[model samples]
Target: MSRYFPHPAYAEDQPLARTILITHVGTRAITTGTIIGAGIFGTREALRRLRKAAAPSTVTASRSQLYLRVAGHSTLWTIGIVSLGLAGRMWGREEIEWQDRSWRLMENEAQLQTDDWTYGGMVAGLAATALFKRPVGWVAAVGSVGAGSVAGTLGYLGWRYGLQRREPPISE
Candidate 1:
């Protein structure tokens, strides 16, 4: 039985499992960092845009009026950041869970090799996005890269799992 069902022991010896676990952690870290960075930088940019749009007199308005403006902007920024962070965290967790499950079930070494390339591309995309100075550009770039990577990974998992299910079982 152990000879026929050697996957458990093989998994224990394989570094792929550990690497996948580390990848999950890295994904979570990247998600958190991106969310927090976007929130802080985006809020600052939004406030700057608001100030720029205001009339010259508004810039020198009464202290009470200035305080009100600041409070309003801050409230909006806080809400936006919280919403974005929560959504990003939820999505990231789901993605990690899906990947973990997929990798556990995957037996195709070729598919795993393909995943390495796909993940490398994603990291490169993130680096490219991070180079942008503007918050909007950064957010757009990162969001697109993240979304594309998630979609591609899920698609690959689905294809592999579907193929595995369609194959006839071995009877030894």
Candidate 2:
């Protein structure tokens, strides 16, 4: 039965009818808005903090120490982005699951899993760098985490919805 028109037997069952009312277009709109909103606010806050914490350039005691400092900064950046991404992911998943139970829910769950793996991998990279004391510059280290987030988001969207090459799942 259509969610908009509940089965006659469950005509008065309001919750069941409400459970799957978010259409594909509605889901896409909500997800897109959520991502944009979260990204904007998160980036704003990060930038504000960075500006407030700007330090005067000074020669490092040694190249290794400079590398370690950059690695530490990058680790912190990774943690922040991962935390923000996870928070947004959870919020988006909850919203979708509340209004969808089929393909949308499945896709959201998969996206969340992808985010989890990406974030975890970034943390593991930081750990390895710390352990090995490997030299890495700020841009490469920080940009990598940012790239992971972009990749995860785009990868699934492109795979599932790109080019509209296949039909979307039918909604009941």
Candidate 3:
């Protein structure tokens, strides 16, 4: 028999699948952008604290005080938010897969969704860094913003799709 190409499997509900994918990617992009903006602010504060801590007057301060001064409230908050956001990303993976399965999504489609989310997030984060005079605070701001977005998006998706079962589109 002559070799033949295999037919591709399509999602049962193409519209639903597309919606979920688009929503995921869009949420990631917006979240990333927001976080980057926050990062700009945090980066600026961190730099200022760094500069102040390095001054001669603060040189004689105790180790703990020096550390506190270097990592002020804003800096600490930024660090915490970013850390949590990253952790949230890891936590949301299972939920993402669940949604994919619920919608009977194709592998390629899922992968594409993930890739877009990642790339968008990266670009947003970096762009924020560049927009704010190239300050280093973007690291924290982006992280916090990203973290907030992840939590918000995942919660929304899980609640909307996972909690309520919807019928897949009827194939003609």
Mind sharing the TM-score for model 1? 0.32
Q: Which tens-of-lDDT digit does each residue in 27-77 have in candidate 1?
A: 434434444444554576578788886535635444323332343343344
lDDT of each: 0.46, 0.43, 0.45
Model 1: per-residue Cα lDDT at residue 31: 39
Clashing pairs in 3: 35-142, 35-145, 38-141, 39-137, 39-138, 39-141, 43-137, 85-147
Number of the predicted model whose lDDT against the real structure is largest: 1
TM-score, prediction 2:
0.27
Q: Where in model 1 is the C-alpha error above 4 Å?
A: 1-16, 53-123, 126-172
> Candidate 1 or 2, higher lDDT?
1
- Candidate 3 residue lDDT tens string, 2-98: 0111213543423343345444444445455544544565676589798875545645544333322333333445545665664565554655453
How would you order the candidates by lDDT, starting with the best?
1, 3, 2
Model 2 poorest 10 in a row by lDDT: 1-10
TM-scores for the candidates: 0.32, 0.27, 0.28
